[model samples]
Target: MKISHLQTRFILAGILLVMTTVVSGIWSAWTFAHLSEVAGRTIQKSQLTTDLSAVLSDALEREDDALLLAMSGDRGQAQKKLDAERLRFAQAFNRLKENLDQPDQTQALAQLAKHAALYRAAGDVLLTTVAPQDAFRWYYQNVNPALRRAVAACAEIRESNFRAMQRAGIRARDDARGATILVIAISAAALLISTLVAVMLARSVLTPIRELDRSVEALRLGDFERRVEVTSRDELGHLAEGFNRMAEALAEFRRSNLGEVIAAKETLEATIAALPDAVVVIDPDGHIVAQNPLAKAILVATKAQGAKIVDDLPFSAGSLRAVREALEGKPTDETRAELTRAFAVRLDGQPRKFMLTAVSIPEFQPGRCGAVAVLYDVTDFARLDELRTELVAVASHELKTPLTTLRMNLMLLGESAGNLTPRQQEILATAAQGCHELASTIDELLDLTRIESGQLRLSRELVDVYPIIDRAIISLRQRFEDAGVAVQVAAGHRPAFVLGDSVRLGMVFTNLLSNALKYSPRGGCVSISVRSDHNGRGPGVLQIEVSDQGSGIAEAFRERVFEKFFRVEQHLQNGNATTWGAGIGLYLCRQILEAHGGTILCHAGDNGVGTSFVLELPSPGTVEQ
Candidate 1:
């Protein structure tokens, strides 16, 4: 069976413990058996020695009694008793000799036999020839000495057996002690081996675990190169194998994804580089984060020498404000509009027009916002617009002379109506009216062309804006009345004077008032208000607002209303039923106001019923308060 590391350790320890116990038990049993046998032999030899000593003492005592009987004159009975005693003594000596295995015991037994034979011969002489008195003397000399020698020999044999038993007991005890020591040593060795095995097994299991732990930590830190080394065929080895596999998989994943990520990054960089317009990305701190080639080129051209990319870009102050406001998550519509206007920059020793646009990038990082600024080169477009305007101006100027001659001829024809038919006169009148309308259209076109071409020079002077507004209102008063609209002028108590041409300023107000009257419903009120205030750029500015009650301009068309030739679609659909102009009136107003260092904006009226045209003009060096 395939045992796990833990199971193997347990099995080995158990086997060692069982083997140690069984061997110790067997050894103890064998030692005790050998000791018992030695003890038994010693006890039997001691008993045999004791029996031989008793037989020798009895034989000596009976021989002495027979000698006394011979001294008493019973010769036959004494001899018979002596012979029986001698036979018993010989039998005891022979039994001791058969049992005697040691050399000392055998010599003692032979000496005892020699002493008994001499004592028997001496006892027989005493019983056959000597009187009773002589018997006593002989027994005291020869027989008594022989009996003493035999008794001494028997005692020596018993002492030898006893000493042998003592030696045997001592040897048995030493053997038992040696056996105990051997068992103890074997048990100790077994325990030591088992402990070492256990420790080795534990280390075998834990070493891999520690290695795996370190590998896991490395993986967490994104280091996928380290792998666990496999060194066994147990569960720990399998775990190491799995861990190494996991590391390989992670390494592969990182390589594969890294390649794709690098590819994607290159593609993005190439795409940005291929863009036509200059693109710059800035962080919230106004530092440049990234830029395309065009952006770098533009910056190098416009920015200061030796400036770093981390520095703020060279956009106009207004554009910088818009970018900051966007980063702060605030509205930047006005600033954005200002940025979209054409601005001049020197590039390669030539002045070029560029339009800047900034937009906030979405919250890509928490609490950190960024913005993208685009610089569009519109120099060619502006030059084209200027050229087209010049061409139109030239065309308009060429048509004006013929148009004036036609108007004069029509007037002459009208005066001669008496000589003409009624149909001819009617045809002459229509021709005169058509020529007037055409002349007015030509005049508007010429004025727009002059404004776009930068040829509309202003004669600057300090003039009160109220009088200019009043003159414009009076000139358009009859038209407003015909359209069933009312005109109201409200000026501040103090006069608001600005540096501008009075005629041009009046034209601005006239166009605004005329549009208000045209778009107003019957009996709707058109109010003109002029006030003096700061216009955000500096102190001492004039603010004028013209509001009318009419169908309001849609929010979508508000910005486009100032665009050239762009009329609201709904107004165009109304056609001839409603009063309409060629749409350059508002465009001209914008150009005129902008040229005078002023601004014009259209908004919904207070009640959201009509359009409000707001004009801001910079005050002259001095303000009349």
Candidate 2:
């Protein structure tokens, strides 16, 4: 019960989500608790401090009235006021103590109590003073001051507690907010993981079903060329494997049982008739086992018998000796020998190329061994191969002279045109540009040869494509500006990086840009766009498309455009006649893209208007498959 990759992703995402949610919830709860405690403390301190101050103020006012009444010699009034004042002070003391949130404030409260008692005694002494002024002075210097100090002490306690509570509240709130953010981040991460997991599971289940459907469709179309890929040893993998085996077995059974097995004589006759060549088989007894229709025509045209052996035929002595050696198993490889010696046999009085191949037939009884010989006409392929080789060689030599002369002229123009007139300089510059293009064309030819010979080596690495595009444009910017072509490079996003040989990638872009610039008319736009999209399986990919408002490919020759040495024009004219180099730029581009596990294709560019070369490259993976 091995899970698919999609299933694994889904499970992983779910686990991440759950863990994040739980952790965030726990953190948030803890923060909230701390915040609540701090808020409670703050409220307690504020109320207690505020009420204590009001009570103290009232007590001070009553004491002042008592002093004034005694000074006026109103003894009964003074005594009554004194009594009220003492009672008020006592109430304030009790309330202050009650308001303190901590036991440490108890000592401060006790001190306030002692101070209040002392202040009351001092006030009584002043009220009954023999010298009234002395009593007033005593009240002012002792009782009133003592009362003020006691109130100040209580206020200080309240202030300290208030500050402590405020700080605590702030810290608690901050903690709570921080916890909430953590919870949110974790929850988001979890949600993302969950989504990823669901997607993975769906993909896992759907991928195989899709592949099965595709295979079935292929089978329906009479294509039995595909096999299901086993990505895992899971039940699905096993099922796919079994289904593939069944398809293979059925295909083989159908091939084997669809028709009866023909007799040896009939099989030989069928093989000869189906083959586009004359065929003859002879046993050791020198009797002809079989002769195809072509072989019978040959025998009749030469006035020979079809049932006779080759020794009786009008073939040369060398061919007869080779046949005799094949019969005796004396030839090399103990099988067969064939010679290209000419014979007098004719078909409609026409001479045609023939390739003779002979092999011994071991199924014959002892002392009756035989060999089968087949002839083929290979004149067309052999001639084309030879002519192509000659063309490559001749073109290489012919292009070299012009290339050298062009380089020399560029060098001379650059050196001598230092103080030339504007028109003169312009001509020289144009000539130099033409020379460079010719050199580039030659380089393309050489590159194609290297590619075909499997000599192209790629050194791959992670590369930033922007710099390559920038560099290519910089190298060709002057050329484009001079040609009056508008060259544009489209900004690319995704995979942010690509894996390739920078030099090779640069060459690819440079070639495309150059082609676009060369072919595009003045004021026409040549755009280079890079794109990347995920293939929905592994890492995403990056692609570059270079398009130009130039002549598009002909309908009939679209597929043949990438072939080496294939030019669009049948006869190269003056401007295009210098196609001295082998036409291999597009071919090389295709090879390079393919080597990077990418693809390059030409499409009908801009509504059958211009040519567009699209290149799709894989963001090379680390794991080698």
Model 1 TM-score on a 0 to 1 scale: 0.52
280-356 in candidate 1: lDDT tens per residue?
A: 77777767767888777777787643434433566667777777776776655532252225767777788887777
All models: lDDT? 0.79, 0.70
Q: How many angstroms is residue 377 displaced in model 2 relative to the true structure, after the best TM-score fit?
A: 7.5
Candidate that would win on TM-score = 1
lDDT of 1 at 623: 54
Give one digit per residue, the lDDT tens place, for model 2 in 1-625.
Answer: 6555545655666776677668767766776776677677667666766677567656766776787788778988887887787687777766776676555456656666666667667766676654875766676787778777766666666666666566666877787778678777766777776677667666777898899889988887877766788776656777789979978987887678656445655776687788787788888766777878887777787778644766776565656666666676654221122112224345777755455556666656676568776655545544554466457656866897978987897787679887899898998888877877777766666565456446778899988777888899998999888889988877655324678888888888887787777668888999888776755478877777889998766665665666655666664334553223345666677778888888888877887878888888876423222
Model 2 steric clash pairs: 6-200, 10-197, 17-190
Candidate 2 total steric clashes: 3
The 10 consecutive residues of candidate 2 with the worst lDDT sum are 332-341
Off by over 4 Å in 2: 1-409, 412-416, 494-496, 534-538, 571-582, 620-625
Clashes (N, CA, C under 3 Å) per candidate: 0, 3
